[model samples]
Target: MTFEHYLALFIAMFLVAVIPGPAVFAITSASIARGLKQGVNMTVGLLLADYLFILLAISGLAVVAEVLGSAFVIIKYLCAAYLIWMGISLLRAKPGTSITEPKMQSTQSAVLSGFLLTLSNPKAIVFYVALFPTFVAIENMTYPDILGIMACATLAFGSVNLAYVYLGSQARKLLTTPRRLTLLNRCAGSVLAASGVTVAVR
Candidate 1:
Protein backbone atom coordinates (compact mmCIF):
# COMPACT_ATOMS: atom_id res chain seq x y z
CA MET A 1 0.00 0.00 0.00
CA THR A 2 1.05 3.54 -0.70
CA PHE A 3 1.47 6.06 2.13
CA GLU A 4 -1.80 7.79 1.19
CA HIS A 5 -3.78 4.57 1.36
CA TYR A 6 -2.18 3.68 4.67
CA LEU A 7 -2.97 7.12 6.05
CA ALA A 8 -6.58 6.95 4.86
CA LEU A 9 -7.00 3.55 6.43
CA PHE A 10 -5.52 4.85 9.66
CA ILE A 11 -7.88 7.85 9.77
CA ALA A 12 -10.93 5.80 8.92
CA MET A 13 -10.11 3.23 11.56
CA PHE A 14 -9.39 5.92 14.15
CA LEU A 15 -12.70 7.65 13.48
CA VAL A 16 -14.51 4.37 13.83
CA ALA A 17 -12.92 3.90 17.24
CA VAL A 18 -13.63 7.49 18.30
CA ILE A 19 -17.27 7.38 17.26
CA PRO A 20 -18.40 5.52 20.43
CA GLY A 21 -20.14 2.58 18.86
CA PRO A 22 -21.07 -0.67 20.60
CA ALA A 23 -17.46 -1.60 21.31
CA VAL A 24 -16.60 1.82 22.73
CA PHE A 25 -19.70 1.84 24.92
CA ALA A 26 -18.84 -1.55 26.32
CA ILE A 27 -15.26 -0.61 27.16
CA THR A 28 -16.00 2.86 28.49
CA SER A 29 -18.76 1.63 30.71
CA ALA A 30 -16.44 -0.97 32.14
CA SER A 31 -13.85 1.67 32.76
CA ILE A 32 -16.41 3.85 34.48
CA ALA A 33 -17.86 1.02 36.54
CA ARG A 34 -14.95 -1.20 37.50
CA GLY A 35 -11.72 0.70 36.77
CA LEU A 36 -8.96 1.13 34.19
CA LYS A 37 -7.67 -2.41 34.64
CA GLN A 38 -11.04 -3.89 33.74
CA GLY A 39 -11.27 -1.64 30.74
CA VAL A 40 -7.86 -2.72 29.50
CA ASN A 41 -8.83 -6.33 29.92
CA MET A 42 -11.97 -5.67 27.93
CA THR A 43 -9.84 -4.13 25.21
CA VAL A 44 -8.03 -7.44 24.77
CA GLY A 45 -11.34 -9.01 23.87
CA LEU A 46 -12.09 -6.32 21.33
CA LEU A 47 -8.63 -6.71 19.88
CA LEU A 48 -9.29 -10.38 19.31
CA ALA A 49 -12.61 -9.60 17.66
CA ASP A 50 -11.10 -7.03 15.32
CA TYR A 51 -8.32 -9.38 14.33
CA LEU A 52 -10.73 -12.17 13.49
CA PHE A 53 -13.11 -9.93 11.55
CA ILE A 54 -10.41 -8.14 9.58
CA LEU A 55 -8.92 -11.45 8.53
CA LEU A 56 -12.31 -12.73 7.46
CA ALA A 57 -13.21 -9.56 5.58
CA ILE A 58 -9.93 -9.29 3.72
CA SER A 59 -9.69 -12.93 2.77
CA GLY A 60 -13.34 -13.31 1.80
CA LEU A 61 -13.36 -10.08 -0.21
CA ALA A 62 -10.15 -10.99 -1.92
CA VAL A 63 -11.95 -13.95 -3.41
CA VAL A 64 -14.93 -11.82 -4.41
CA ALA A 65 -12.67 -9.27 -5.99
CA GLU A 66 -10.86 -11.94 -7.92
CA VAL A 67 -14.08 -13.49 -9.21
CA LEU A 68 -16.13 -10.37 -9.92
CA GLY A 69 -13.46 -8.71 -12.05
CA SER A 70 -14.54 -5.09 -12.52
CA ALA A 71 -17.98 -5.79 -11.09
CA PHE A 72 -16.47 -5.65 -7.62
CA VAL A 73 -16.36 -1.89 -7.91
CA ILE A 74 -20.08 -1.85 -7.21
CA ILE A 75 -19.38 -2.80 -3.62
CA LYS A 76 -17.49 0.44 -3.12
CA TYR A 77 -20.58 2.53 -3.87
CA LEU A 78 -22.70 0.39 -1.62
CA CYS A 79 -20.22 0.88 1.21
CA ALA A 80 -20.19 4.61 0.59
CA ALA A 81 -23.94 4.68 0.91
CA TYR A 82 -23.82 2.66 4.11
CA LEU A 83 -21.30 5.02 5.70
CA ILE A 84 -23.28 8.13 4.77
CA TRP A 85 -26.44 6.61 6.17
CA MET A 86 -24.69 5.83 9.47
CA GLY A 87 -23.31 9.38 9.55
CA ILE A 88 -26.75 10.88 9.09
CA SER A 89 -28.19 8.59 11.73
CA LEU A 90 -25.57 9.61 14.29
CA LEU A 91 -26.12 13.24 13.47
CA ARG A 92 -29.86 12.88 13.98
CA ALA A 93 -29.74 10.70 17.09
CA LYS A 94 -30.39 12.17 20.52
CA PRO A 95 -27.48 12.89 22.80
CA GLY A 96 -26.34 10.13 25.09
CA THR A 97 -27.80 10.42 28.56
CA SER A 98 -25.49 8.20 30.57
CA ILE A 99 -23.05 5.36 30.43
CA THR A 100 -24.72 2.10 31.28
CA GLU A 101 -23.38 0.36 34.37
CA PRO A 102 -21.46 -2.74 33.27
CA LYS A 103 -21.85 -5.83 35.43
CA MET A 104 -18.95 -8.04 34.51
CA GLN A 105 -17.48 -9.36 37.75
CA SER A 106 -14.48 -11.40 36.71
CA THR A 107 -11.52 -10.87 34.41
CA GLN A 108 -12.79 -13.61 32.09
CA SER A 109 -16.25 -12.09 32.01
CA ALA A 110 -14.87 -8.66 31.23
CA VAL A 111 -12.90 -9.96 28.28
CA LEU A 112 -15.67 -12.22 27.11
CA SER A 113 -18.21 -9.43 27.29
CA GLY A 114 -16.20 -7.16 25.07
CA PHE A 115 -15.30 -9.92 22.64
CA LEU A 116 -18.85 -11.11 22.27
CA LEU A 117 -20.16 -7.59 21.94
CA THR A 118 -17.81 -6.76 19.10
CA LEU A 119 -18.01 -10.16 17.45
CA SER A 120 -21.79 -10.13 17.49
CA ASN A 121 -21.99 -6.70 15.92
CA PRO A 122 -22.58 -7.36 12.21
CA LYS A 123 -21.81 -3.75 11.49
CA ALA A 124 -18.20 -4.46 12.35
CA ILE A 125 -17.87 -6.97 9.55
CA VAL A 126 -19.74 -4.87 7.04
CA PHE A 127 -17.80 -1.73 7.80
CA TYR A 128 -14.41 -3.42 7.67
CA VAL A 129 -15.18 -5.27 4.47
CA ALA A 130 -16.72 -2.28 2.74
CA LEU A 131 -14.10 0.13 3.99
CA PHE A 132 -11.21 -1.99 2.75
CA PRO A 133 -11.71 -1.28 -0.93
CA THR A 134 -11.96 2.40 -0.23
CA PHE A 135 -8.20 2.38 0.26
CA VAL A 136 -7.15 -0.96 -1.18
CA ALA A 137 -7.55 -2.92 -4.35
CA ILE A 138 -8.35 -6.33 -2.95
CA GLU A 139 -7.57 -7.92 -6.28
CA ASN A 140 -4.04 -6.70 -5.91
CA MET A 141 -3.75 -7.41 -2.21
CA THR A 142 -0.61 -9.17 -1.02
CA TYR A 143 0.43 -10.71 2.26
CA PRO A 144 2.24 -7.51 3.18
CA ASP A 145 -0.86 -5.47 2.41
CA ILE A 146 -2.94 -7.70 4.62
CA LEU A 147 -0.37 -7.43 7.41
CA GLY A 148 -0.24 -3.66 7.09
CA ILE A 149 -4.02 -3.42 7.16
CA MET A 150 -4.15 -5.49 10.33
CA ALA A 151 -1.45 -3.34 11.92
CA CYS A 152 -3.31 -0.14 11.13
CA ALA A 153 -6.46 -1.57 12.64
CA THR A 154 -4.64 -2.65 15.78
CA LEU A 155 -2.84 0.64 16.30
CA ALA A 156 -5.87 2.81 15.68
CA PHE A 157 -8.45 0.80 17.57
CA GLY A 158 -6.16 -0.08 20.47
CA SER A 159 -4.99 3.49 20.93
CA VAL A 160 -8.53 4.85 21.01
CA ASN A 161 -9.67 2.23 23.49
CA LEU A 162 -6.76 3.07 25.77
CA ALA A 163 -7.48 6.76 25.56
CA TYR A 164 -11.11 6.20 26.38
CA VAL A 165 -10.16 4.06 29.33
CA TYR A 166 -7.68 6.62 30.64
CA LEU A 167 -10.11 9.49 30.24
CA GLY A 168 -13.03 7.58 31.71
CA SER A 169 -10.89 6.43 34.61
CA GLN A 170 -9.97 10.02 35.45
CA ALA A 171 -13.29 11.76 34.87
CA ARG A 172 -15.97 9.43 33.66
CA LYS A 173 -18.41 12.30 33.66
CA LEU A 174 -16.46 14.40 31.21
CA LEU A 175 -17.01 12.26 28.14
CA THR A 176 -20.36 10.73 29.07
CA THR A 177 -22.14 14.01 29.74
CA PRO A 178 -25.06 14.80 27.44
CA ARG A 179 -23.64 18.02 26.06
CA ARG A 180 -20.16 16.70 25.48
CA LEU A 181 -21.49 13.48 24.00
CA THR A 182 -23.66 15.43 21.60
CA LEU A 183 -20.73 17.42 20.29
CA LEU A 184 -18.68 14.27 19.91
CA ASN A 185 -21.45 12.49 18.08
CA ARG A 186 -21.82 15.34 15.63
CA CYS A 187 -18.10 15.54 15.06
CA ALA A 188 -17.94 11.83 14.45
CA GLY A 189 -20.90 12.13 12.10
CA SER A 190 -19.21 14.81 10.06
CA VAL A 191 -16.05 12.73 9.76
CA LEU A 192 -18.02 9.71 8.66
CA ALA A 193 -19.96 11.72 6.09
CA ALA A 194 -16.82 13.29 4.67
CA SER A 195 -15.14 9.89 4.49
CA GLY A 196 -18.06 8.51 2.55
CA VAL A 197 -17.94 11.41 0.14
CA THR A 198 -14.26 10.88 -0.38
CA VAL A 199 -14.79 7.21 -1.12
CA ALA A 200 -17.61 7.95 -3.54
CA VAL A 201 -15.69 10.65 -5.33
CA ARG A 202 -12.69 8.43 -5.74
Candidate 2:
Protein backbone atom coordinates (compact mmCIF):
# COMPACT_ATOMS: atom_id res chain seq x y z
CA MET A 1 0.00 0.00 0.00
CA THR A 2 1.06 3.55 -0.63
CA PHE A 3 1.94 5.76 2.32
CA GLU A 4 -1.19 7.79 1.68
CA HIS A 5 -3.30 4.65 1.89
CA TYR A 6 -1.65 3.66 5.16
CA LEU A 7 -2.21 7.13 6.60
CA ALA A 8 -5.84 7.07 5.57
CA LEU A 9 -6.34 3.67 7.16
CA PHE A 10 -4.72 4.87 10.35
CA ILE A 11 -6.99 7.92 10.51
CA ALA A 12 -10.08 5.81 9.88
CA MET A 13 -9.10 3.38 12.60
CA PHE A 14 -8.33 6.25 14.95
CA LEU A 15 -11.76 7.73 14.41
CA VAL A 16 -13.33 4.39 15.09
CA ALA A 17 -11.32 3.97 18.26
CA VAL A 18 -11.87 7.45 19.71
CA ILE A 19 -15.62 7.35 19.45
CA PRO A 20 -17.17 6.60 22.79
CA GLY A 21 -18.77 3.17 23.00
CA PRO A 22 -19.43 0.32 25.37
CA ALA A 23 -15.86 -0.93 25.05
CA VAL A 24 -14.51 2.50 25.90
CA PHE A 25 -16.70 2.72 28.97
CA ALA A 26 -15.74 -0.77 30.06
CA ILE A 27 -12.04 -0.12 29.86
CA THR A 28 -12.23 3.16 31.71
CA SER A 29 -14.49 1.75 34.36
CA ALA A 30 -12.22 -1.22 34.82
CA SER A 31 -9.35 1.08 35.50
CA ILE A 32 -11.30 3.29 37.87
CA ALA A 33 -12.87 0.50 39.86
CA ARG A 34 -10.12 -2.06 39.78
CA GLY A 35 -6.69 -0.83 38.72
CA LEU A 36 -4.61 0.17 35.75
CA LYS A 37 -3.50 -3.43 35.38
CA GLN A 38 -7.07 -4.54 34.93
CA GLY A 39 -7.64 -1.80 32.41
CA VAL A 40 -4.51 -2.84 30.53
CA ASN A 41 -5.69 -6.42 30.47
CA MET A 42 -9.03 -5.36 29.09
CA THR A 43 -7.29 -3.28 26.46
CA VAL A 44 -5.20 -6.27 25.47
CA GLY A 45 -8.28 -8.42 25.23
CA LEU A 46 -10.03 -5.88 23.05
CA LEU A 47 -6.97 -5.71 20.80
CA LEU A 48 -6.98 -9.49 20.48
CA ALA A 49 -10.62 -9.38 19.50
CA ASP A 50 -9.79 -6.76 16.88
CA TYR A 51 -7.10 -9.03 15.42
CA LEU A 52 -9.60 -11.86 15.28
CA PHE A 53 -12.03 -9.71 13.35
CA ILE A 54 -9.29 -8.56 10.99
CA LEU A 55 -8.25 -12.14 10.29
CA LEU A 56 -11.82 -13.21 9.68
CA ALA A 57 -12.39 -10.24 7.43
CA ILE A 58 -9.29 -11.04 5.38
CA SER A 59 -9.78 -14.79 5.12
CA GLY A 60 -13.51 -14.77 4.43
CA LEU A 61 -14.08 -11.48 2.64
CA ALA A 62 -10.96 -11.74 0.51
CA VAL A 63 -12.38 -14.73 -1.31
CA VAL A 64 -15.71 -13.06 -1.80
CA ALA A 65 -13.95 -10.00 -3.15
CA GLU A 66 -11.87 -12.14 -5.48
CA VAL A 67 -14.78 -14.15 -6.86
CA LEU A 68 -17.33 -11.39 -7.00
CA GLY A 69 -14.79 -8.78 -8.09
CA SER A 70 -16.86 -5.78 -9.15
CA ALA A 71 -19.46 -6.72 -6.57
CA PHE A 72 -17.25 -4.99 -4.04
CA VAL A 73 -18.43 -1.71 -5.45
CA ILE A 74 -21.85 -2.50 -4.10
CA ILE A 75 -20.32 -3.60 -0.82
CA LYS A 76 -18.53 -0.29 -0.56
CA TYR A 77 -21.77 1.63 -0.84
CA LEU A 78 -23.37 -0.65 1.71
CA CYS A 79 -20.53 -0.12 4.15
CA ALA A 80 -20.68 3.58 3.59
CA ALA A 81 -24.39 3.52 4.28
CA TYR A 82 -23.80 1.65 7.50
CA LEU A 83 -21.21 4.16 8.63
CA ILE A 84 -23.51 7.04 7.88
CA TRP A 85 -26.34 5.43 9.76
CA MET A 86 -24.09 4.84 12.74
CA GLY A 87 -22.93 8.41 12.61
CA ILE A 88 -26.44 9.80 12.54
CA SER A 89 -27.47 7.60 15.41
CA LEU A 90 -24.49 8.69 17.41
CA LEU A 91 -25.27 12.29 16.67
CA ARG A 92 -28.76 11.93 18.03
CA ALA A 93 -27.69 9.97 21.05
CA LYS A 94 -28.22 11.56 24.47
CA PRO A 95 -25.36 12.44 26.74
CA GLY A 96 -23.59 9.31 27.85
CA THR A 97 -24.27 8.04 31.33
CA SER A 98 -21.46 7.27 33.70
CA ILE A 99 -20.44 3.71 34.40
CA THR A 100 -21.08 3.73 38.08
CA GLU A 101 -20.65 0.08 38.86
CA PRO A 102 -17.79 -1.76 37.33
CA LYS A 103 -19.07 -5.19 36.37
CA MET A 104 -15.60 -6.62 36.31
CA GLN A 105 -14.56 -7.94 39.70
CA SER A 106 -11.23 -9.43 38.67
CA THR A 107 -8.55 -8.96 36.04
CA GLN A 108 -9.54 -12.23 34.37
CA SER A 109 -13.15 -11.16 34.30
CA ALA A 110 -12.15 -7.75 32.99
CA VAL A 111 -10.21 -9.29 30.12
CA LEU A 112 -12.94 -11.80 29.37
CA SER A 113 -15.62 -9.17 29.52
CA GLY A 114 -13.71 -6.93 27.16
CA PHE A 115 -13.24 -9.79 24.70
CA LEU A 116 -16.87 -10.85 24.80
CA LEU A 117 -18.09 -7.27 24.61
CA THR A 118 -16.01 -6.65 21.50
CA LEU A 119 -16.89 -10.01 19.92
CA SER A 120 -20.58 -9.45 20.54
CA ASN A 121 -20.46 -6.30 18.48
CA PRO A 122 -20.69 -7.61 14.91
CA LYS A 123 -20.37 -4.03 13.70
CA ALA A 124 -16.59 -4.06 14.01
CA ILE A 125 -16.30 -7.27 12.02
CA VAL A 126 -18.50 -5.90 9.29
CA PHE A 127 -16.46 -2.72 9.39
CA TYR A 128 -13.27 -4.65 8.79
CA VAL A 129 -14.91 -6.65 6.01
CA ALA A 130 -15.99 -3.43 4.35
CA LEU A 131 -12.80 -1.56 5.11
CA PHE A 132 -10.17 -3.93 3.74
CA PRO A 133 -11.36 -4.11 0.16
CA THR A 134 -11.91 -0.38 -0.04
CA PHE A 135 -8.36 0.42 1.00
CA VAL A 136 -6.28 -2.54 -0.14
CA ALA A 137 -6.51 -4.33 -3.46
CA ILE A 138 -7.73 -7.70 -2.30
CA GLU A 139 -6.21 -9.65 -5.20
CA ASN A 140 -2.74 -8.38 -4.41
CA MET A 141 -3.13 -8.37 -0.60
CA THR A 142 -0.31 -10.34 1.08
CA TYR A 143 0.36 -11.52 4.62
CA PRO A 144 2.70 -8.62 5.28
CA ASP A 145 0.09 -6.24 3.96
CA ILE A 146 -2.47 -7.70 6.32
CA LEU A 147 0.04 -7.47 9.14
CA GLY A 148 0.67 -3.86 8.29
CA ILE A 149 -3.02 -3.09 8.45
CA MET A 150 -3.32 -4.87 11.75
CA ALA A 151 -0.37 -2.94 13.09
CA CYS A 152 -2.00 0.32 12.11
CA ALA A 153 -5.21 -0.81 13.73
CA THR A 154 -3.35 -1.82 16.87
CA LEU A 155 -1.57 1.49 17.15
CA ALA A 156 -4.72 3.49 16.60
CA PHE A 157 -6.93 1.39 18.82
CA GLY A 158 -4.37 0.81 21.55
CA SER A 159 -3.27 4.42 21.83
CA VAL A 160 -6.74 5.90 22.28
CA ASN A 161 -7.84 3.08 24.55
CA LEU A 162 -4.75 3.27 26.69
CA ALA A 163 -5.18 6.99 26.90
CA TYR A 164 -8.59 6.49 28.40
CA VAL A 165 -7.08 3.98 30.78
CA TYR A 166 -4.38 6.38 31.80
CA LEU A 167 -6.73 9.27 32.18
CA GLY A 168 -9.02 7.16 34.34
CA SER A 169 -10.98 9.63 36.46
CA GLN A 170 -9.92 12.56 34.32
CA ALA A 171 -11.55 11.04 31.29
CA ARG A 172 -14.76 10.68 33.22
CA LYS A 173 -14.61 14.36 34.13
CA LEU A 174 -14.38 15.31 30.48
CA LEU A 175 -17.57 13.42 29.76
CA THR A 176 -19.46 14.45 32.86
CA THR A 177 -20.52 17.80 31.53
CA PRO A 178 -23.40 17.76 29.07
CA ARG A 179 -21.84 20.48 26.92
CA ARG A 180 -18.56 18.62 26.60
CA LEU A 181 -20.31 15.34 25.93
CA THR A 182 -22.48 16.83 23.23
CA LEU A 183 -19.48 18.41 21.58
CA LEU A 184 -17.65 15.11 21.64
CA ASN A 185 -20.55 13.32 20.02
CA ARG A 186 -20.90 15.96 17.35
CA CYS A 187 -17.22 15.86 16.43
CA ALA A 188 -17.20 12.08 16.34
CA GLY A 189 -20.41 11.89 14.32
CA SER A 190 -19.24 14.42 11.78
CA VAL A 191 -15.94 12.64 11.29
CA LEU A 192 -17.64 9.27 10.98
CA ALA A 193 -20.13 10.52 8.40
CA ALA A 194 -17.43 12.28 6.46
CA SER A 195 -15.29 9.17 6.45
CA GLY A 196 -18.22 7.18 5.12
CA VAL A 197 -18.78 9.65 2.33
CA THR A 198 -15.09 9.65 1.49
CA VAL A 199 -15.10 5.87 1.22
CA ALA A 200 -18.19 5.87 -0.93
CA VAL A 201 -16.87 8.39 -3.46
CA ARG A 202 -13.20 7.46 -3.49
Candidate models: Cα lDDT each: 0.66, 0.66
Give the Cα-based TM-score of candidate 1 against the true structure: 0.60
Angstrom error of the Cα, residue 151, model 2: value is 0.8
lDDT at residue 128 of model 1 (Cα atoms):
66
Write candidate 1's Cα lDDT for 38-104 as tens digits. 7898888788878877776766844653576454355445545544654565577677633332343
CA RMSD, predictions in order: 10.0, 9.8
Model 1, residue 100: C-alpha shift (Å): 17
lDDT at 116 for candidate 1?
53
List candidate 2 segments past 4 Å from native: 61-107, 169-202
Candidate 2 per-residue lDDT over residues 72-119, each given as its tens digit = 466556645644654565567666532222343366755665665465
lDDT value, candidate 1, whole model:
0.66
